[model samples]
Target chain A: MSTRKQEFLAGARNTFPLLLGAFPFGLIYGALAVTSGLSVGAAMAMSAFVFAGSAQFIAVGLVAAHAPVLIIILTTLIVNLRHMLYSATLLPYLKKLPQTWRIPLAFGLTDETFAVAIHRFRKNDSSRFKHWYQFGSSLAMYLNWQLWCFLGLVLGDRIPDASGWGLDVAMPITFIGMLIPFVKNIPTVVCVLTAGAVSLLTLGMPYKLGIIVAAFMGILAGFITEQTGKKIQVEIQV
Target chain B: MTANEWLMILGMMGVTFGIRYFLLALADRIRMPSPVEVSLQYIPPAVLIAITLPAVILPHGEWHFSFTNPYLVAAVIAAGCGLLTKNLLATIACGLAAFFAYQILLSS
Candidate 1:
């Protein structure tokens, strides 16, 4: 196989597991966007432009609530701030990539894309193929997302309403599936509890500001727990 | 005109692209604080739970702390199944089953 083909193959292999999650999630997004009163064009366009699943869900909720557009924009910012970290993690590997390859790759850096690509890069222990691997993984995920989302929009009306089809269960179920893998550390456990409590407490807040509050509180709680752990580790060494 | 909507979407896209690219461009010029790194690591699980729990338990916009709410029961089962199996499909199936079963029991 040619070097390019090899890189693409490696990318596909790395992203296959991520696609398992993205397919259903994108379907849920498409179905929700349609049922939430978005035009099929708008829904598909959103997948093309925004491409962030959770942010799109929040946008649908805001649309349903008749929220001001400014608030929607602000909420999207806060919710997606974590993408900065993804960009940060990939920066070292991407330093040598030309602008032609960088912009599209940056747009495709969703949670699953970053996870699979980073995992591959770490496992490979080589920077030579990092960009190629990332490109491949992200391309697969991007294509998978667009296809499922389009399918969902096309078949959206046929699917039963949220109450009838139990489609409302998708988000929570997906989240639960994600959470199971990360509860190993005490810091993570504390972060979940603190964020949950904070979110519930602030549920009455307006314009989904509660999400922002919960996010900040959760981050603080996690940092404290991590620091405490590190301090204990140091003392133990001493 | 509703053309404004498209403009708004495009403008928002610009803003988003700017934020994401800002750090990508600055990655070499600066180092993130230790606290910032620690906090970013915790964001996924925290945000996921924050978004999920309310939707499941507060389907009616109020806390219905009872077994009568089928969605909550289904969510708990789904969460357990997910934790045990670590599969999205399995978790969603359990949730769907619990939701429909509770709905049936409620009607009966």
Candidate 2:
């Protein structure tokens, strides 16, 4: 097999665990979207077009709340603002690629894809087609999302109180798994602690604005901790 | 779907794509500020914690920080497993097992 093929398969294989985690989430989104008043077509369309899982879930909740269109849109913007950072971090590796590749890759970019692809991109590999790995992950996520969403739409009613099943807990667990490895240092510990505290304090913020606020607070805390650590090192050296 | 819902979905699509595309499209032409670039390293950890912390602690959208909260228990167990093993599979498996076990214990 070609190197591209290897990268692609590797991407898919790595993301498979995440796909399993998202399965119930996609199903819950579909079932709840319909039960919350979205038509079958619209629910599927949202899954297809607005592919961000968390954002789509929040948007559906807002829809059920009868929130104004502008609020829903605004909420989505804030909730997904993290993706801006994602694109920025990815820019270094992907900047040289053509728009055709970047566009689809960007469309397929999700928390899961970002998680899988960034590792490969950060690797010291000689493969020029690392983008293919991202492509494989993105395509897998997109297709996986659509398939589960459709199944949920079809079998949603049959599942009976599907939203109460707690399958969504898989996502948070997976996130914990992803995040634990990052809490190795003082700065990262500060970052995670601050983010957790701030999110809890701001939990009542509308449209889940608390998430953005907490994320920034965490980043700021981490940056300060790092800077302070450097300053202490300088003082000790003096 | 109604025209209004379609409009909302389109609006959502546009905003989501625009945010993701903005930086990737202009990456070569533009240089991020030093602070923004430096802080980028913290984005993954910060955002993931921000998203998951509340969900685990407040599984029902209500405060439940005690050991009685299955989500909290599971998360603690998962964190331990993750730190010790540095393995995703072990973390998730341990977490779910703890979660189900806690659920059964609490309900019983």
Candidate 3:
């Protein structure tokens, strides 16, 4: 296969698990959006336009609540601010790519795409094939997302929201599953616990700003813990 | 709604694409601070907790919690199942069952 084809294949392989996981989420979102008073068109449009699962979930909820358009937009911005950081982390590697490649790749960057791409990028130093890996990983996720959205739109209302379906919990369960593997150290543990506490305390904040605060606090806690660990190591060496 | 009614939808799409693509185009021109990178890691967990906590702690359509609240019980069961099985499908099944069982018990 050509280099591009090889990369696409690799991307598909890495994204297989993530794509499977996201399928139920798209279905759930479609069902929820319909029940939440969004027309099928709006629901499908959201899937097509936003292309971010969590953001779409939030958007549907906000629309249902009759939140002002500006507030809804602002909430979406805050919720997705983390993507900017994802962009920053990949900056060093992506900076070397052509503008055409970088722009398209950036549009394709989602949690699954970033997760798979970063794993590959960190595992090897094959600088020449960076875009190939990114393309491979992101393309699979992108296609998977679009496919699931389309399926959901077609059969969403008929899916039936019930306990037996158990699709609503897919998202939360997926997140917990993802988090467990990453909580490999004391710093990560501390950050999660501290953030959880803060988020709980500020749960009533309007517009979901508490989420932003909790995330900020968790990041701060993680950074501080890392700095402290480094200081101790330096002290011991001295 | 008709296609003509979807001008707003197209606008939303334009805005989204702008956010995703604009940052990449501007990456070389501007640098993000160290703090921004640090905070990004916590976003997923924080957002997850934020969304989940209200569903459990706050009863639907009410600000307070009570024993009658099935979501709370279901959430506890769900969390336990999540830790034990470490399987998404299994955990969700457990949670959904617990939630419905509570609702059914209360109604009956």
Winning model by TM-score: 2
Q: Estimate, for each residue in B21-80, the C-alpha lDDT of model 1 and write its tens digit.
A: 666666566576766755666766776677777877787688986898887888888788
**Docking quality class, candidate 1:** acceptable
Better of 1 and 2 by DockQ: 2
Best by lDDT: 2
Top candidate (DockQ): 2
The runs of at least 3 residues in candidate 3 whose Cα sits more than 4 Å from the true structure, single-residue gaps closed, are A1-3, A62-71, A162-166, B1-5, B32-108
Candidate 3, position B24, lDDT:
75
lDDT at position A164, candidate 2: 88
Candidate 3 docking quality: incorrect, acceptable, medium or high: acceptable
TM-score of every candidate relative to the true structure: 0.78, 0.94, 0.76
Candidates in order have lDDT scores of 0.72, 0.87, 0.67
Cα displacement (Å) at residue A97, model 2: 1.3
Chain B TM (all candidates): 0.77, 0.90, 0.75
lDDT of 1 by residue, A35-101 (tens): 7776777777777787777777777677677776787777777667666656776766676667767
Q: Which residue pairs collide, candidate 2?
A: none
Give residue A208's lDDT in candidate 2 (0 to 100): 78
lDDT of 2 by residue, A125-169 (tens): 588989999998988888999999999999898889999877778
Question: Which window of ten consecutive residues has the lowest lDDT sum in model 1 chain B?
Answer: B1-10
